[model samples]
Target: MAEKEAVEATVTGNDQQVGFRAMVMKQAIAYNLAGSARNDANEIVHFTLQGDKHRIDSALATLQEGTKRSSDIKIATTSAAIDPGLNAFTIVDWTSSSRNITNTYNLVFELRADDTAISPTDAKAAWHQILEKTLNADDLKKLQPND
Candidate 1:
């Protein structure tokens, strides 16, 4: 199915604060939200994201910590025509006097899982690569089994 192009995700909590912007940016980038965010005088964090539906959904889900404070987050959607030329989702600089971005959208292809791990060595290396790449994902941690 074809995915939507634009998403207006309004994250909650610390919206009136400056440091929270960094936290939101990190989480959004990890999930590949191509847009920008900044704190406004109305205490609302305005975010303009242009990306695939799955990536945008994933970013929104991450922002919802299930806490009371996080529940305040809200989002509104509409059909938008975007230039599908972006290489990847990114956080654009919002410091410019004009808060505008060269909007572009691209379908992010998922890597196939190495289910061909028929051997222990192969399985180890495949899993190792997955873990190593996840280093930048703060939301991801060392895998643990049910003790």
Candidate 2:
């Protein structure tokens, strides 16, 4: 079998509040890739693609093409460690209820887990549990960077 590869992609500009993440998920699924997509506090869309290099490249092509609502799209991709645990592509929810940097870090750590079998959803839930034990909602709000 061909070596499985992965890429960490950060997409900015006209990528948020649209269906870009969902569209990317669809493309990734069509390509049979495994990874995730989510929007960040700064209106940036971050995603990861893991699987065959050719398929990843194909998905990247479609992503670069942009959705109808997307303009000025800029995507930066770096080679990433393959996550063998990701069984399917998913769109993670990034709500503004408690937008702390820790949430992003947790998601990043989960996505980059090279030796674990935990899914992103499971990992995020576990991270939330840690936060629940250590901090209240008000404390989490304090951790959010000042606008």
Candidate 3:
């Protein structure tokens, strides 16, 4: 309950990071979501996600799936409750970095749903799906430093 409103979830990946914001302003717009991205000092990224559960979900999916550069990555998600007054779901601004762990970065996200906010559990759920699409065992192994 708590009058669900927004969902702020954080993501972690390879030595780089990025975030997504600005709710799906354009009706049925392309999946090309927009926001900000950066390189954190902690080797971990910090990004935000602002949009409906579906929008954020799909975007996160992309992150998990990854691009041509990076491959499967280890991730963690922490959820936060939001207000119920937001008109539409929109990602605000993302703060990323590359110093979370060794050869890893931090990922932070702020998302909006219908009434209340999405719980960390739910956030991780969505993030988990994204990771599944993006990462694999080899990707996770290579990120490790020389043992």
Identify the leading candidate in terms of lDDT.
2
Alpha-carbon TM-score of each model against the true structure: 0.45, 0.62, 0.38
Candidate 2 lDDT over residue span 89-128, tens digit each: 6667633333433332222222332433344345435444
Which candidate leads the pack in TM-score? Answer: 2
Sorted on TM-score, best first, the list reads 2, 1, 3
Candidate 1 lDDT tens digits, 60-110: 665554323334444544445564554333332322111221222221212
Q: List the residue pairs that clash in candidate 1.
A: none
105-135 in candidate 3: lDDT tens per residue?
2232333323344443455454434333444
Better candidate number, 2 or 3, judged by TM-score: 2
lDDT agreement of model 3 with the native: 0.36
Q: What ranking emerges by lDDT with the best candidate at the front?
A: 2, 1, 3
After superposition, candidate 3 runs with Cα above 4 Å error? 1-5, 15-37, 83-147
As a whole number from 0 to 100, the lDDT of residue 2 in candidate 1 is 38
